[model samples]
Target: MSRRIPLPPPPPPAEIQSWPDREARLVDRALAMDELGRRLLGGRRLTLFLVWFVLLELGWSFVGVALTAFDHGQIDPITLMLVMFSTCVGLAILVPAVWMTVRGILRDRVARERLAQWAALDSHPATDARLRAPTLGLCWLLLSFAMCAVGLWISFAVPAGTSREDGGYGFVAYGMGIGLILWITGLVGLTKAVGHYRFAVRLTGRPGPRSASSGHPRPE
Candidate 1:
């Protein structure tokens, strides 16, 4: 299902702004959330994960081949070897990746809570637009899906239609791999963006004396 993402109010008018030193520092700390999002979604760790994911795919392919061989009554030493090899290889990579993914998600959930609170605040008008805008997330989501569709087409259609002599399968596999990586990355980005937006909307809706009314610049 599609979700309705809440946007922060438009960039407040630019004007001379002043705040207590402590509040300014808090605001700066809060603004650091933008840097955090960029690192999490568009940084080296994501690249590392993408590279690691290919091995997971390779392991799955081995398992699939083993199962196919067993189904075709090719049960022998080779089949036994494939099964044992796939099982060992799969667990070797799968366990650590799963653990890392779960740990990252839990930590991010807590960080997202903080981001939502900061986003809900009425910060000084001069704050960077990245904080208020979900454009980066949306771009990642759309690009990922588009690339994934392209990958699916390449994986199935190109290999099936092309003659073996043409050797299109290798290229197709490359495209498919990239698409899969982007799709996973996009899913993670979407989750972070949506979670933050929902919490921000809820926080903004609640009744309270916001810092804006206190006659000082908003706190981070």
Candidate 2:
């Protein structure tokens, strides 16, 4: 006589499994942490760049004051032209250079966040590929600025022919010529860099994974 065997307790229901739910909770928590990290990093990066920018501006102001003292009232037409030309070039280059650097830094931060997201997923590709353009632009701008600064210094050092000569034309001409060339080269590089960044943004989408989404489960 076989005793009536009690059926084994039925497997837990889907909702009771707890694993998926727990996983979802963990994912939510990780995402939150990732967002916080991004915000912190972004703020720090911007602060650093801002400080650098202020320093650059201060140096430029000092140089302008010195130039004014040296050439006050007795400006050479040729030197004036060079100064005007260099000023134009500097303005043109500076706007985009700062823009590209800031943009690149932001992209880099996004890439880092993507990396953190990938760690949880089944597959995660590196975002470094997206950085190529911005990085290139940054390098080009830095090089161009350095070259221009050097040219300006050299212009000041050239011998003056007479007391009437402020050496402005010679200084301005050589400095502006070198600066213009560098600015043109930087612009070309900046264009290429921007294209690369756009392509990367299209591929990965801006603010990926960590993007704002209420559907994302809340962390436990």
Candidate 3:
């Protein structure tokens, strides 16, 4: 006992608590809740976009049918060919444009959600994914337009036979119809793939930075 000072009493458990640790736990919980809310809203937005897409397609189809019926008699071979080409080009552009717009909206929403999550947790993986639907959609649009151009070239270069028996304009019409159908099917598939990717990202909390890139979950 060589003049040892009396040991101080042990500190209370509460006194030993770390404020930073408590705050971090609170922040993590808040972030998880925020992410949940954001996902809920994202789901609603996705549903609305889908409904809008359906309505737009239905309206456009009805109008196209009406116009064709009204002008069927007045459309000559050249005019018919032009109409077919125009319709293809219009669809090629329209589908992508709509997809891009929808993607932009969804992207903004996701960004906002991510920001909120970041604010709470102060942690997020750096991401360069800007809504790329527009870019990819544009690429597809250009490809479809190019295909339509090729069809147009074929239509003009293929000589209209002197005799109606040679199937003059009918052959061109049939070819145009088939090409249009194929083009539309391709676009539809592309859009569906995009939608599937989006859903997967949302469901799995994966970051899809590009159209083809796969997102992986953060390890627990």
Which candidate's lDDT is highest? 1
Q: Please tell me which predicted candidate would have the highest TM-score against the true structure.
A: 1
Candidate 2, residues 143-166: lDDT per residue as tens digits? Answer: 545545554544454433323355
Q: Write the per-residue lDDT of candidate 1 for residues 36-101, one digit (tens) a residue.
A: 445444445355445545555654554444444443444678768877887677667656665666
lDDT of each: 0.50, 0.42, 0.42
| Rank by TM-score (best first) | 1, 3, 2
lDDT of 3 by residue, 1-220 (tens): 1442222221123335343654564444344434433332344434444454444454344335434433345667776676676566556655764675466455544544443333223223222122223444344445545545654554454444323454444444544444454445345434533553464244335432211123222211
Number of backbone-clashing residue pairs for each candidate, in the order shown: 0, 0, 0
The lDDT of model 1 is 0.50
* Candidate 3, position 128, lDDT: 14
Cα TM-score of candidate 1: 0.55
Q: Comparing candidate 1 with candidate 3, which one achieves the higher TM-score?
A: 1
